[model samples]
Target: MSDVSTPDPRQSRLFTASELLGYLVLAAVIFIVLPSVLDAFRLNLFGKYLSYAFVAIGLVLCWGVGGILSLGQGVFFGLGGYCMAMFLKLEASTPENTSIQSTPGIPDFMDWNQLTELPWWWVPFNSLTFTVVAIVVVPVILAFIIGFAMFTRRVGGVYFAIITQAIAAIATILIIGQQGFTGGVNGITDLRTLMGWDIRPDSAKTALYFVNGVLLFAVLFVAHMILKSKAGRLMIAIRDREDRVRFSGYNVANFKIFVFCAGAAFAAIGGAMFTLQVGFISPTLVGIVPSIYMVIFCAVGGRLSLLGAVYGALLVNWAQTTFSESFPELWLLAMGALFIAVVMAFPLGLAGLYDDYLKRHIDRLLAPVDRMMMRRAARKTSPKAPAPTAQAAE
Candidate 1:
């Protein structure tokens, strides 16, 4: 008698229908019910979280999936933000008949610079089309060049992270030093409008919130698709064993650069959207600290899951906003402790834990159905009795 126990095949398929329904229901609650109930301030705060989500997406792609630790996403984010800020500032200044060469006599930093004429580079940014294009293109180009050089030279791991941090530091310092052009340490602020729309109005803020929501959805969808594709599989392979992948006929360098560039571009888009909503841009927003914070968001959310990155960014930022005002002194410490706890307890991240728990629940719920299907399949595939054996017996 054969005593082999066949394994159930139902466990192998990704995400069951009930699981999908649960996700859809959860999404509906967030995108539909929450917005309707939340006040404008809360909605705006959520919008800011969504911007952070954009940066977290990049972190997940590079660090979580591609094994590239980039500590300089803030630089790219700042670059895109400042680009938009420049155009907005130029537009606001020009209508008031202020020449780039003359002192605008508005912000203290610009006043102290003792300069008026808009820099040559600032001219193109005044064009809305140019600003929009720059927001996406500039970061991608920069990432491509930097990533191409670094990956080609085989610079990775902690060294790559250090280089990225250094770049972010340099960028912050450069923006601070170029007082005349970049508004120096004070950065750029006192923005009034974006693409000619009044940012101060409730309607505009609401519109901005919806825009952010749509962008977040779009980014999440794209990320999900990429993660499920052949290229994504190759990325995982490279992450697991780079040399083996190289030997298996894949150009590891190209894949790394591609993901790096894509992450940068996503960050830039988020930065631009953030600048538009906030109606302000500053170097502080794009410094080393913020870049590190971006990584923290991804780590806390569950680096391996795209949804985790988004959830982490939103949850962490929400906590910062909620507690920092009331307990300013303890806020940073609290955040740090929370991060440590998450890293220590849930190394796979909150999303990973949630997913694992969900899978277990689903397996239990579907066990009977799975067993029934397996039995039916087995019966159908079982061998028929031999008629000759019966006739011989008779």
Candidate 2:
């Protein structure tokens, strides 16, 4: 037998000690440091930004790993937001609260639009259970249909991206045009409570922020697992050479469909959380522009790194907020210039920067820690020294 030992497949699926440390650092920042440093209001704002991290992470899986670019992630995000919004709107639209309106039990926007009775479809959302299910299922189903129709026919590349953008435009138009049903241009707003919990207060908002952070880490774990598995390997292979994967008897379209649906599911969860954090869902969030913004988030973070995508969302949004406040008239121009500069200077993004320069130094610093861990693992796996035989005991 060869002297070299075979690597552990199960161990290979887990993150390395260095990678685990990175995750722990992020968790500390989110759960401990940020909450301690920032007040509730700023923390709430960060919660909103973290919501966008969901979409960015999805883009990493779809566009980065799978090589399936989708510009309509906003559609999935919006759908989730709307689902949650619809449920919240129903909860807030108590007949006693809306006694002033002609329709005493319906949403204010519906009342304004002369909807006498709740729409048939809106009735199901009255149940929170259904709303939660729909948030993930609805977007995934739509993604499945689209992925099936497009991938089966081999429709991809720039063409696939443009089609997704068009879908976003259509979704936005539909939401706005159906004002009575969807809250129209203003979108759903003035959400106050969830399951009888008043979420508008500072204390409540802080709680929600922690919840968002926990959920984000959960997503990161899932994404990391997917990326470390055989499926992840196949995705990378397909991204590099789809024809070769197909020729090898793999169902390329099915893999594409799965990843696309997964991306949509992730975006949808983000949308739902966004509605909870921000108190609204708008047509503006479901349009082509927002979809493009999501892609930019992934690209800026290093499309391949899940943790990088989260940081990208937080940093980019922070800059946008700062610029918009300081230079309201020129913020958009500044953002455009910033993006151009980043792309020109660092083609691979923040993660790429770390890999190229920082990783080696960091690894060197952690070498001792790594060695200790390896020693422990070897001790656990190595055979105990053979017990001295009875005859040899002397």
The TM-scores, one per candidate, come to 0.85, 0.92
Sum up the clashes in candidate 2. Answer: 0
Best by lDDT: 2
Q: How many clashing residue pairs appear in each of the predictions shown? A: 6, 0
- What TM-score number comes out for model 2? 0.92
Q: Give the CA lDDT, 0 to 100, for residue 298 in model 1.
A: 94
**Candidate 2 C-alpha lDDT tens digits along 182-247:** 999999999989999998899998999988899899889888988988899999999999999999
- Model 2: colliding residue pairs: none
Lowest summed lDDT across 10 adjacent residues in model 2 is found at: 1-10
Candidate 1 lowest-lDDT run of ten: 1-10
Task: Please identify model 2 stretches exceeding 4 Å from their true place.
Answer: 1-11, 371-394
